[model samples]
Target: MSSDDPLAAALAAAGLGGVQPGDTRPPEPRIEVVSDDPAEPTGPRELWPEGIGTGVGSLPGTDPREASALVTGETPEFPAFPELPARGVGADMIGRTAGLLVDLAVEVVPTGWRVTARTGRDLRRARDLLAGDLDAFDDACDRIRPHWVKIQVAGPWTLAASVELASGHRVLTDRGAVREFAASLGEGLRAHVAEVAERTGATVVVQLDEPGLPAVIAGSLSTASGYGTVRAVRAPDAQDLLRDLISGIAAPVVVHCCADRPPIRLLAGAGAAAVAIDATRPAFTGTTAEPRALDAIGETWDEGVPLLLGLLPGTAPEREPAIGDLARAGYDLADRLGFDRRRLARLAVPTPACGLAGATPDWARRALTLSRELGKAFADPDE
Candidate 1:
């Protein structure tokens, strides 16, 4: 590969050089290194320690209990840990979180549920931290940044699921509101991506975090006042809206669903560069789960769409396969599924099935380190 055309190299390696909307490409075949920008200043401090709450920025204006009830089949309270300080310094959360995130960016693994932005302020803090992140990523593009660094934003569905309109209606119910909010989100996302590029100068893979896509499609989201389920919107409109929302960003986009019922066909058809599923979540990789997801995965891979398969279990260390074993296991599965192992080497990024905020800091760090090591082992198996 030449120095000037990494994108071409990535697309060619991933079997996506000529594929189109209808053609499924083969499994992934490119490896990415993350950028390293360490000079940015530290952001605000966190009030709470890690591993204690529902995570930062759970949803801006909704009742957590209601949202959880719909998804978990259980009653819910506001999952935010209000007791924890939402702000201060010496907070290692972002740094520690980044270490875990970059480890699994391009390599396939189960990774979703962002804790980096635990509160509204955390997002602003992230902007501050990005200076360092970008600087670090740009300075050592070859050493730290992944060939495809995955950057996430709250998805429209989840945004609709979590955010509330001023009139107390679910955002999804109001097409206008959803469009406006998504547009705003796109602006923030572009800035985030630009910062990443400024720091790393490599391809930045933007992943939209949507846990409520299934519910939104099924018309299950309730209004902010808890009146009733929001009306379902047409698929074409949703896809078009999302496409516009994602416009202006140069990097390939991936829609990530940690929840069951990811709108695979919709996302695929929506022109998303890829669909990232939380393999650790039964909603996706369950033994008795629907075959459509697998078929979709295969189809997407064949169409040159990369799948960020999250194979690591979601719980603590006790529940997941060892990092070494997990990498080998995924490679084997990819081969059996007709994907070339080399493609798997590039397409797969090893990660925990979901977010690690629920795990101890020690566990989170370990998971990240293990992911990097696994990538190394897979990349140079002959060694």
Candidate 2:
């Protein structure tokens, strides 16, 4: 039946309709909490590498070695591969992900990177920068043999939205291109994770950055000409592509979206081992939390999935809050959701509310330090 059909509309309103034949909607996810009982065979507990806190990637610097060393020193238990977008062009999100496209090449344009017919200078530079960063990361690991390390990349939807096709439209505008890009990214990420593991002797966790996802899903992205909005991708299509990408990576996947209304259920359904969100974001604060956001959080926790709660500000505040003050909101949220405060320690990890690239170097360091303290607060709020 058509979406306009009265019955179809009614069914959709009831949350039981709108699915047509050959629909790609994934099976409704089962939301059972994995037993917290120690005797039960539980999944890995190091979702954020247990008891540690880390950055949201992108430090403020041009030196990969220095950036990596700082991250290793600060978040030794869960250090993330630092990204330096200040290096320009090839170092930004789209350029970085484009470097991982196997067989496909992209070149920088005034608007952004656009697909090219063959490998070229732009593509080579992007790949080289990534290689250099990895080497720097390896060197940092040599000094500090961390047990687990995280690497971030743009998620499929965000990548598709950021990179343009040869025709200049976004890759998200073409279903075929979206699938191909997802496959290539998956292949590349597997290789990337394997290499990190080999060099660091650490378990690798992959975080997919999807900051642009809410815009992509809401059809808020501008057209190539800036005259109209690009068509919004359906949630099922987005979830299927993400699931495919996640399945190909051999490491735990964390979907990080700083959007006010991240698609928490969609990310969880796509098999994300965890979802990262900015809990301190203004939208989630105040008298009434956004019902949908609250529901998503509750549902995500109900499924035994951990949340990387972005608790600390990316930049230093005029007056820094105490660890308890920084962590109070999350504790309050848990209570409001009817969860025991202890669950915060078991299923939550503290992080800076977002990336720190925009912050001064001093604030970046301070923010990371506070994040570690917040993790401790979660573990022992009374201390």
**TM-scores for candidates 1 onward, in order:** 0.61, 0.87
CA lDDT of 184 in candidate 2? 91
Give the lDDT of residue 142 in candidate 1.
Answer: 36
Over the stretch 166-214, how does candidate 2's per-residue lDDT look in tens digits? Answer: 8999998998998888889998888889999999999999999999999
Off by over 4 Å in 2: 1-49
In lDDT terms, how accurate is model 2?
Answer: 0.87
> How far does residue 126 in candidate 1 sit from its true spot (Å)?
8.0
Task: State candidate 1's TM-score.
Answer: 0.61
Top model by lDDT, which number? Answer: 2
Report every candidate's CA lDDT.
0.52, 0.87
Per-candidate clashes, comma-separated = 44, 0
Clashing pairs in 2: none
Report the lDDT tens digits of candidate 1 across residue range 131-157.
443443344343433333455566776
Q: How many backbone clashes does candidate 1 have?
A: 44
